[model samples]
Target: MSEKILELKNISKSFSNLIANDGVDFDLKKGEVHALLGENGAGKTTLMNILYGIYKPDAGEIFLEGKKIDISSPRDAIENGIGMIQQHFSLVPSFSVVQNVALGLKELGIIPDLSKVRKRIVELSNRYKINVDPGAKIWQLSAGEQQRVEIIKLLYVKSKIMILDEPTAILTPQEAKGLFETIREMTANGASVIFISHKLKEVLEISDRVTVLRHGKVIGTVETKGSNENDLARMMVGRDVVLKIDKKPSHPSKPILKIENLHVIGDKGIEAVKGVSLEVKGGEILGIAGVEGNGQRELGEAIYGLRNYTGNIFINGSKVRSGDVLERIKNHVAYIPQDRKADALCGGLPVYKNLFIKAFSSPVFSFNPYLFYPEKLRKPAEKLVKEFSISTSSVDQEVKFLSGGNMQKVVLAREIESEPKLIIAVHPTRGLDVGAEEFVYNVLLAQKERGTAILLIAGDLYEIFNLSDRVGVLYEGQIIGYSEPDESHIEEIGLMMAGVKNEDKI
Candidate 1:
């Protein structure tokens, strides 16, 4: 048997009243890619945090190279050749890659040698095929490039054990493939990796061994070659999980949302959406498929009254007022923004408060002039929590403590419960697990059955083809192609997404 590089025995952790991880055992062999598989709130992140010394285990023993050791702080972990790259990066936007890597190096004196750092970065980048530029600022790089910088930083520290949390959540398919290659290179050089991801397909493709966690206990660990996605899903969720969505044929009614000759400028003072026209009818989903930063954000914002635009936007046959979010809400427009952290929920507030934030003005929750009843808010919140199957202890629990899947559920529960006529859902299931994604699809379909028009903007082609009645491809701020979701039209849609129009190709 190969040498065990790291091991955790009976590891446990808690946050206040929440038992994040029960007695759990995990181990990694040298040069092996060990995957941690679980649903949201399944204690995967908690276990990894303990391994990285971000949290001290309440009860457990850690072993490095067959010798018991203590990892009480990040410095201790780093000293022991362990490093972690979290889902949210820690790089400064304005700093260059080398500078970011050298920020906390104790050995590098106040006047550190920049040339040495750059050379080391280049060496690592070339070794792993990470393809990062040492002199480029963090903000100037794409999401994939930024991820490379994080990996390079870990390598620069001479880490033998790397823990990556949700590494491919925001990456494109091509970018994910590149990252998989880099992982192979790292493992080939005798380094171990603990990859935590909700993507089952990637797990099967990349991991040598997979461990499943549920609630706070270890379900089982299996060799990847013998297990399929079904087996993994069953182990993680404790039940058979549905990976595909089933929906009846869409019977679109009269138009509910109409945009004609819409033009909008991006934050960079350039026209991001140009003369785009589309209509979403009642009881239909119009999915826009495109790469990231292809003006989908601007289009969604313009319709939701969050951005200034020159055009006609009619919701329910009435012209929407420009830059009036509240008025759009009054007209029964519910928008689920792409950035849930910044645009959707207030992290500091309780789940119940966020659930009823938009409904406070309604008569049901208001008691007197300029006053609101807490009891009224609590009742509805309790009902929504139950209906949505949110995994929080109580409605009063802060949303920040919930998992990404649960936070998305809260956003969906709040928006869908309002009985809106028009729904603008942007990457609604971006970071959610398979179970939560199924729940989101079911909710959207239920709303569609109630005659709501939905504009679904997403980067995932599978999602676009799954639920969209009509698919439109957006490229460089233009609606390049439109077609029904049929097998024959997929290749054409792909070409359009790459900015190649059918006519242009001809």
Candidate 2:
């Protein structure tokens, strides 16, 4: 029999009262793609971290090719031929792809000649059918191109076993398809892969076998062909998981939010959001759909009062040209930012404290300077945590300790619970598993039922179709076309996303 390339035996890890990884066993076969499936905070990342030497396993044994091994750090894991590409990519945005790849490797004291590295990168990219411009700055590349850079970085290091965490979270459907093909090509070249994701269809499509984790425990492992999304979701959540986003038929009323001739420059000094006009009605979710980096982020930030924008923005019959961010919020507006780590929550603070960030000065949670009562704040914080199904030990727990999805839940809980007239949710369910996505959808539907106007800016076409009452296709920072959700097709939106106008283009 072929040797198992990697083996993790009875791994367990913890952080305070949270047992991130219970006794779990995992193995990877050479030249095979093994998928790790679970809900958010189901110990998938924790387990991968233990393998990649980011965290020490309290009780476990790691074996490489039937021989026990000790991996003490990220360097150690890399030296042992294991490479990890994280969800939030670690790249110097201003540096070229080759420079970013060669940054840490320069410590080897080798001759600092980038030509050799560039040649090797080209060879690797061709071998794996992955294309990345080594001379392109990280910021100059699209999210898909940046992902290819990450994969190329691993390949440049001669990594035989590659681990990708939530690889498709930010990719469009077409980009995701390309990535799956690349994974197959890697495995074909004798590289074993550990694919970590909560996306069920992609997992079944790419993996040879699947392992489900739940609350730090390994629930089951099954052949990909023998299993289905429903079976895997049940194992991950330990229940009959509902995958559908339920909603009542959209009854859009008068326009509550309107934008006219809006234009904004991206961070790179390019015109990101072009002249665009759109309207969102009361009790409606207007989903902005497109390939990411096509001006979606800039549009959301500008409308949410985070960016300096040249345009007309009207909220509830009032012009919001001169209003500060807080002023906008006070005028019945709430924003859940796209990059949760940098913009949404304060990671160092407790969950309750983070919840009070925007509301701390508001009379609802505080009275005056040096005279604050947490009891009143705690009541609502606790209630929001429960309502959002946040899995934290307590509201007093540091926000950083919560999983990505849970931290997102805290952001949503704070933003949505206050009952704002207009809510801007940007990729609100970005990294969540099936169950959590359903919960968020239900929350949005509930808000719509309350006649709240919602602007959902997301890259996932399926999500936009499923949850939005109407979708506006954003291309080159402008709303190119608008379509009723039920009447539109994914291909139409996709074409518009690439700046192909249906009327102008044959």
- lDDT winner: 1
Each prediction's total of clashing residue pairs, residues at least 3 apart in sequence or on different chains, is 0, 0
lDDT of each: 0.88, 0.86
> Which segments of candidate 2 are over 4 A away from where they belong?
106-111, 364-367
Worst 10 residues of 2 by lDDT: 484-493
TM-scores for the candidates: 0.95, 0.96
Clashing pairs in 2: none
* Over 4 Å off, model 1: 363-370, 486-488
lDDT tens string, model 1, 1-506?
27899989999888878888899999999999999988878888888888888889899999999999999888899999999988778999999999999999998998999899999998888899988889999988877789999999899998999999989877877789999999999999989999988889999999999999888889998999999988988888778888878877888999999999999998778899999999999999999998878899999999999999998999999898878898887898999988787788999999999998887666665556557567778888999998877878788899998877788889989898999999999988876777777788888988898899999998888787778888999999999988777667878888888899878866
For residues 1-506, write the lDDT of model 2, one tens digit per residue: 15589999999998888888999999999999999988878888889889999999999999999999999898999999999998778999989998888888845356667887788888888888887888999988987899999998888888989999988887888889989989988888889999988788899899998998888998888989889988888888878877766557878888889999989888889899889888899999999988788888888888888887887999998888632687777877889888898998888899998887787768855576677777877888888888778888889999998887888888888888878899998998888888888888888888998899999998777678778988889887778897766534766776788888878666
Q: Model 2 compared with the native: what TM-score?
A: 0.96
